[model samples]
Target: MNTTSLPKPNSMEFDIHAKLKAANSHWSYCYAVHPHDKGFDYQFNTTFVGEMEFAVYERIENYFVLVDFFKSYDEACDDAKKIIDDHPDIKKMFSVS
Candidate 1:
Protein backbone atom coordinates (compact mmCIF):
# COMPACT_ATOMS: atom_id res chain seq x y z
CA MET A 1 0.00 0.00 0.00
CA ASN A 2 1.35 3.42 -1.03
CA THR A 3 0.19 5.98 1.48
CA THR A 4 1.76 8.75 -0.55
CA SER A 5 -0.80 8.21 -3.31
CA LEU A 6 -3.56 9.59 -1.13
CA PRO A 7 -4.73 13.10 -1.92
CA LYS A 8 -3.40 15.93 0.19
CA PRO A 9 -5.72 17.82 2.50
CA ASN A 10 -7.46 20.85 1.03
CA SER A 11 -7.05 22.87 4.16
CA MET A 12 -4.68 22.90 7.11
CA GLU A 13 -6.97 24.44 9.71
CA PHE A 14 -6.44 21.50 11.99
CA ASP A 15 -2.77 22.39 12.30
CA ILE A 16 -3.52 25.85 13.64
CA HIS A 17 -2.71 26.14 17.34
CA ALA A 18 -4.83 28.40 19.49
CA LYS A 19 -2.95 29.99 22.38
CA LEU A 20 -4.70 32.10 24.96
CA LYS A 21 -4.04 33.48 28.39
CA ALA A 22 -5.07 31.42 31.38
CA ALA A 23 -8.13 32.73 33.21
CA ASN A 24 -6.52 32.76 36.64
CA SER A 25 -2.86 33.17 35.85
CA HIS A 26 -0.37 34.67 33.43
CA TRP A 27 0.44 31.27 32.01
CA SER A 28 -0.72 30.05 28.62
CA TYR A 29 -3.47 27.68 27.55
CA CYS A 30 -3.41 26.01 24.15
CA TYR A 31 -5.37 23.56 22.07
CA ALA A 32 -4.00 21.92 18.95
CA VAL A 33 -3.77 18.79 16.86
CA HIS A 34 -0.92 16.34 17.30
CA PRO A 35 0.06 12.83 16.37
CA HIS A 36 -0.70 10.10 18.87
CA ASP A 37 2.19 8.97 21.03
CA LYS A 38 2.99 6.28 23.58
CA GLY A 39 1.63 8.44 26.37
CA PHE A 40 -1.98 8.43 25.15
CA ASP A 41 -4.21 5.78 23.59
CA TYR A 42 -7.89 5.89 22.82
CA GLN A 43 -8.25 2.08 22.91
CA PHE A 44 -5.46 0.54 24.91
CA ASN A 45 -2.68 1.34 22.42
CA THR A 46 -4.70 0.10 19.48
CA THR A 47 -4.06 3.30 17.60
CA PHE A 48 -0.66 3.94 16.09
CA VAL A 49 1.59 6.93 16.72
CA GLY A 50 0.97 8.35 13.24
CA GLU A 51 -2.70 8.86 13.96
CA MET A 52 -3.71 12.51 14.47
CA GLU A 53 -5.64 13.76 17.49
CA PHE A 54 -6.47 17.04 19.20
CA ALA A 55 -5.35 17.96 22.69
CA VAL A 56 -6.21 20.77 25.05
CA TYR A 57 -3.64 21.81 27.62
CA GLU A 58 -2.68 24.50 30.07
CA ARG A 59 0.79 25.62 31.08
CA ILE A 60 1.14 26.60 34.69
CA GLU A 61 4.52 27.89 35.82
CA ASN A 62 6.98 25.19 34.84
CA TYR A 63 4.51 22.36 34.19
CA PHE A 64 1.70 21.47 31.83
CA VAL A 65 -1.76 20.09 32.56
CA LEU A 66 -3.53 18.06 29.94
CA VAL A 67 -7.18 18.93 29.87
CA ASP A 68 -8.79 16.75 27.20
CA PHE A 69 -8.41 15.00 23.90
CA PHE A 70 -10.59 14.60 20.83
CA LYS A 71 -10.45 12.13 18.00
CA SER A 72 -11.43 14.70 15.44
CA TYR A 73 -10.25 18.25 14.77
CA ASP A 74 -13.76 19.69 14.59
CA GLU A 75 -14.72 18.15 17.89
CA ALA A 76 -11.77 19.75 19.68
CA CYS A 77 -12.14 23.13 18.04
CA ASP A 78 -15.86 23.27 18.76
CA ASP A 79 -15.37 22.47 22.41
CA ALA A 80 -12.67 25.09 22.78
CA LYS A 81 -14.82 27.68 21.04
CA LYS A 82 -17.77 26.83 23.24
CA ILE A 83 -15.67 27.16 26.36
CA ILE A 84 -14.50 30.60 25.36
CA ASP A 85 -17.90 31.79 24.19
CA ASP A 86 -19.81 30.49 27.18
CA HIS A 87 -17.41 31.64 29.88
CA PRO A 88 -16.92 35.30 30.59
CA ASP A 89 -13.44 34.88 31.95
CA ILE A 90 -12.28 32.82 29.00
CA LYS A 91 -13.88 35.14 26.48
CA LYS A 92 -12.20 38.17 27.97
CA MET A 93 -8.85 36.51 27.63
CA PHE A 94 -9.05 36.71 23.86
CA SER A 95 -7.16 39.62 22.36
CA VAL A 96 -9.81 40.25 19.73
CA SER A 97 -12.18 43.03 20.65
Candidate 2:
Protein backbone atom coordinates (compact mmCIF):
# COMPACT_ATOMS: atom_id res chain seq x y z
CA MET A 1 0.00 0.00 0.00
CA ASN A 2 1.22 3.49 -0.83
CA THR A 3 0.10 6.14 1.58
CA THR A 4 1.19 9.75 1.50
CA SER A 5 1.49 11.79 4.65
CA LEU A 6 -0.34 15.10 5.00
CA PRO A 7 1.54 18.30 5.52
CA LYS A 8 1.67 19.81 8.99
CA PRO A 9 -0.75 22.70 9.44
CA ASN A 10 0.09 25.96 11.12
CA SER A 11 -1.66 27.07 14.27
CA MET A 12 -2.60 30.36 12.60
CA GLU A 13 -3.50 31.07 8.98
CA PHE A 14 -2.27 34.12 7.08
CA ASP A 15 -3.75 35.82 4.04
CA ILE A 16 -1.52 36.50 1.10
CA HIS A 17 -3.94 38.81 -0.71
CA ALA A 18 -6.53 41.18 0.61
CA LYS A 19 -9.95 41.31 -1.05
CA LEU A 20 -10.39 44.85 -2.31
CA LYS A 21 -13.80 44.54 -3.76
CA ALA A 22 -16.75 46.89 -3.73
CA ALA A 23 -19.04 46.83 -0.75
CA ASN A 24 -22.03 44.50 -0.71
CA SER A 25 -20.71 42.18 -3.37
CA HIS A 26 -22.91 39.22 -4.25
CA TRP A 27 -21.80 35.79 -3.10
CA SER A 28 -22.97 32.23 -3.73
CA TYR A 29 -22.71 29.42 -1.22
CA CYS A 30 -24.47 26.93 1.00
CA TYR A 31 -24.66 27.17 4.76
CA ALA A 32 -24.13 24.10 6.88
CA VAL A 33 -23.48 23.52 10.50
CA HIS A 34 -20.71 21.36 11.77
CA PRO A 35 -21.53 17.66 12.01
CA HIS A 36 -21.42 17.87 15.79
CA ASP A 37 -23.26 21.15 16.11
CA LYS A 38 -26.21 21.03 18.50
CA GLY A 39 -26.77 24.54 19.64
CA PHE A 40 -28.13 27.61 17.86
CA ASP A 41 -28.53 28.17 14.11
CA TYR A 42 -25.00 29.44 13.77
CA GLN A 43 -23.70 28.03 10.50
CA PHE A 44 -20.89 27.94 7.99
CA ASN A 45 -21.23 28.56 4.30
CA THR A 46 -19.41 26.99 1.35
CA THR A 47 -19.29 28.48 -2.13
CA PHE A 48 -19.22 25.07 -3.77
CA VAL A 49 -19.91 21.46 -3.04
CA GLY A 50 -16.85 20.11 -1.30
CA GLU A 51 -16.55 16.85 -3.21
CA MET A 52 -17.65 18.25 -6.55
CA GLU A 53 -16.00 21.67 -6.54
CA PHE A 54 -13.13 21.08 -4.13
CA ALA A 55 -13.84 23.74 -1.52
CA VAL A 56 -12.78 23.64 2.11
CA TYR A 57 -13.76 26.02 4.87
CA GLU A 58 -13.41 26.79 8.55
CA ARG A 59 -16.15 28.20 10.73
CA ILE A 60 -16.05 30.65 13.59
CA GLU A 61 -19.02 32.32 15.29
CA ASN A 62 -21.49 31.39 12.55
CA TYR A 63 -19.21 32.37 9.75
CA PHE A 64 -17.08 30.39 7.34
CA VAL A 65 -14.00 32.40 8.14
CA LEU A 66 -11.32 30.55 6.27
CA VAL A 67 -11.76 29.58 2.65
CA ASP A 68 -9.43 27.06 1.05
CA PHE A 69 -10.18 28.14 -2.49
CA PHE A 70 -7.31 26.56 -4.36
CA LYS A 71 -6.77 23.62 -2.06
CA SER A 72 -8.60 20.38 -2.68
CA TYR A 73 -11.59 19.73 -0.47
CA ASP A 74 -10.06 16.49 0.77
CA GLU A 75 -6.85 18.25 1.67
CA ALA A 76 -8.72 21.08 3.31
CA CYS A 77 -10.82 18.57 5.25
CA ASP A 78 -7.68 16.86 6.54
CA ASP A 79 -6.31 20.18 7.74
CA ALA A 80 -9.59 21.16 9.35
CA LYS A 81 -9.70 17.80 11.09
CA LYS A 82 -6.27 18.39 12.49
CA ILE A 83 -7.35 21.75 13.85
CA ILE A 84 -10.51 20.41 15.43
CA ASP A 85 -8.69 17.43 16.89
CA ASP A 86 -5.97 19.60 18.33
CA HIS A 87 -8.44 22.01 19.87
CA PRO A 88 -11.65 20.32 20.82
CA ASP A 89 -12.87 23.43 22.61
CA ILE A 90 -13.67 25.16 19.32
CA LYS A 91 -16.63 22.87 18.73
CA LYS A 92 -18.07 23.49 22.14
CA MET A 93 -17.57 27.24 22.03
CA PHE A 94 -19.07 27.83 18.61
CA SER A 95 -21.33 24.93 17.81
CA VAL A 96 -24.02 25.60 15.20
CA SER A 97 -27.16 23.68 14.43
Candidate 3:
Protein backbone atom coordinates (compact mmCIF):
# COMPACT_ATOMS: atom_id res chain seq x y z
CA MET A 1 0.00 0.00 0.00
CA ASN A 2 2.95 2.26 0.54
CA THR A 3 4.34 3.72 -2.67
CA THR A 4 6.86 6.16 -1.29
CA SER A 5 9.71 3.88 -2.20
CA LEU A 6 8.39 2.51 -5.46
CA PRO A 7 10.25 3.19 -8.65
CA LYS A 8 8.53 5.34 -11.24
CA PRO A 9 7.50 3.60 -14.40
CA ASN A 10 8.54 4.94 -17.75
CA SER A 11 6.00 6.59 -20.05
CA MET A 12 3.66 4.14 -21.71
CA GLU A 13 4.52 2.91 -25.14
CA PHE A 14 0.90 2.31 -26.19
CA ASP A 15 -1.98 4.62 -25.40
CA ILE A 16 -4.42 3.40 -22.74
CA HIS A 17 -7.17 5.91 -23.54
CA ALA A 18 -6.89 5.09 -27.20
CA LYS A 19 -7.34 1.41 -26.50
CA LEU A 20 -10.28 2.17 -24.24
CA LYS A 21 -11.90 4.17 -27.03
CA ALA A 22 -11.42 1.39 -29.52
CA ALA A 23 -12.83 -1.05 -27.00
CA ASN A 24 -15.88 1.11 -26.29
CA SER A 25 -16.33 1.97 -29.94
CA HIS A 26 -18.00 -1.37 -30.34
CA TRP A 27 -18.45 -4.81 -28.69
CA SER A 28 -14.78 -5.67 -28.97
CA TYR A 29 -12.85 -4.76 -25.84
CA CYS A 30 -9.09 -4.78 -25.38
CA TYR A 31 -6.52 -5.18 -22.59
CA ALA A 32 -2.81 -4.95 -23.12
CA VAL A 33 0.49 -3.80 -21.61
CA HIS A 34 3.39 -1.85 -23.06
CA PRO A 35 6.46 -0.11 -21.71
CA HIS A 36 7.48 3.43 -22.65
CA ASP A 37 9.10 2.00 -25.72
CA LYS A 38 8.14 -0.36 -28.54
CA GLY A 39 9.67 -3.72 -27.81
CA PHE A 40 7.10 -6.46 -27.05
CA ASP A 41 3.34 -7.37 -26.81
CA TYR A 42 0.77 -9.09 -24.20
CA GLN A 43 0.62 -11.04 -20.91
CA PHE A 44 -3.74 -12.16 -23.69
CA ASN A 45 -7.43 -12.50 -24.26
CA THR A 46 -10.26 -13.52 -21.94
CA THR A 47 -14.11 -13.50 -22.05
CA PHE A 48 -15.74 -10.12 -23.26
CA VAL A 49 -17.39 -7.08 -21.52
CA GLY A 50 -20.83 -8.65 -22.00
CA GLU A 51 -20.37 -11.25 -24.65
CA MET A 52 -16.69 -12.55 -24.77
CA GLU A 53 -12.23 -11.63 -25.84
CA PHE A 54 -7.12 -8.94 -25.34
CA ALA A 55 -1.90 -7.63 -24.36
CA VAL A 56 1.01 -7.41 -21.92
CA TYR A 57 4.17 -6.09 -23.51
CA GLU A 58 6.15 -3.89 -21.24
CA ARG A 59 9.65 -4.13 -19.87
CA ILE A 60 11.49 -1.30 -18.20
CA GLU A 61 14.77 -2.49 -16.83
CA ASN A 62 13.75 -4.55 -13.78
CA TYR A 63 10.01 -4.24 -14.26
CA PHE A 64 7.54 -6.37 -16.18
CA VAL A 65 4.21 -5.16 -17.52
CA LEU A 66 1.12 -7.32 -17.65
CA VAL A 67 -2.39 -6.92 -19.12
CA ASP A 68 -5.62 -8.91 -19.09
CA PHE A 69 -8.75 -8.87 -21.30
CA PHE A 70 -12.17 -9.58 -19.82
CA LYS A 71 -15.85 -10.07 -20.66
CA SER A 72 -17.33 -7.87 -17.94
CA TYR A 73 -16.48 -4.98 -15.65
CA ASP A 74 -16.09 -7.39 -12.78
CA GLU A 75 -13.52 -9.36 -14.69
CA ALA A 76 -11.48 -6.25 -15.28
CA CYS A 77 -11.59 -5.31 -11.63
CA ASP A 78 -10.72 -8.80 -10.59
CA ASP A 79 -7.72 -8.84 -12.85
CA ALA A 80 -6.66 -5.51 -11.47
CA LYS A 81 -6.72 -6.89 -7.95
CA LYS A 82 -4.69 -9.91 -8.92
CA ILE A 83 -2.19 -7.74 -10.69
CA ILE A 84 -1.95 -5.47 -7.71
CA ASP A 85 -1.33 -8.40 -5.44
CA ASP A 86 1.76 -9.05 -7.46
CA HIS A 87 2.46 -5.49 -8.57
CA PRO A 88 1.08 -2.94 -6.15
CA ASP A 89 3.41 -0.27 -7.39
CA ILE A 90 1.78 -0.09 -10.80
CA LYS A 91 -1.70 0.28 -9.34
CA LYS A 92 -2.03 3.90 -10.44
CA MET A 93 -1.05 3.04 -13.97
CA PHE A 94 -4.09 0.83 -14.46
CA SER A 95 -6.78 2.08 -16.83
CA VAL A 96 -10.32 0.83 -17.28
CA SER A 97 -12.12 0.62 -20.62
Clashing pairs in 2: none
What tens-digit string does per-residue lDDT give for candidate 1 at 37-67?
3343121111234544334454433334444
lDDT string for model 3 (1-97, tens) is: 1112212124644444454444553323332334453454323323345434423323434444444333333344344446444654444444464
- List runs of model 1 lying over 4 Å from the truth: 1-50, 77-79, 82-97
Task: Assess candidate 1 and give its TM-score to the true structure.
Answer: 0.27
The lDDT of each candidate is 0.36, 0.38, 0.38
TM-score of each: 0.27, 0.27, 0.22
For model 3, the superposed segments whose C-alpha errors exceed 4 Å read: 1-14, 21-42, 66-97
Model 1, residue 82: displacement in angstroms?
A: 6.2
For model 2, residues 2-76, the per-residue Cα lDDT tens digits are 123233335645231221122122232335556576454333233433322223345556655444322232344
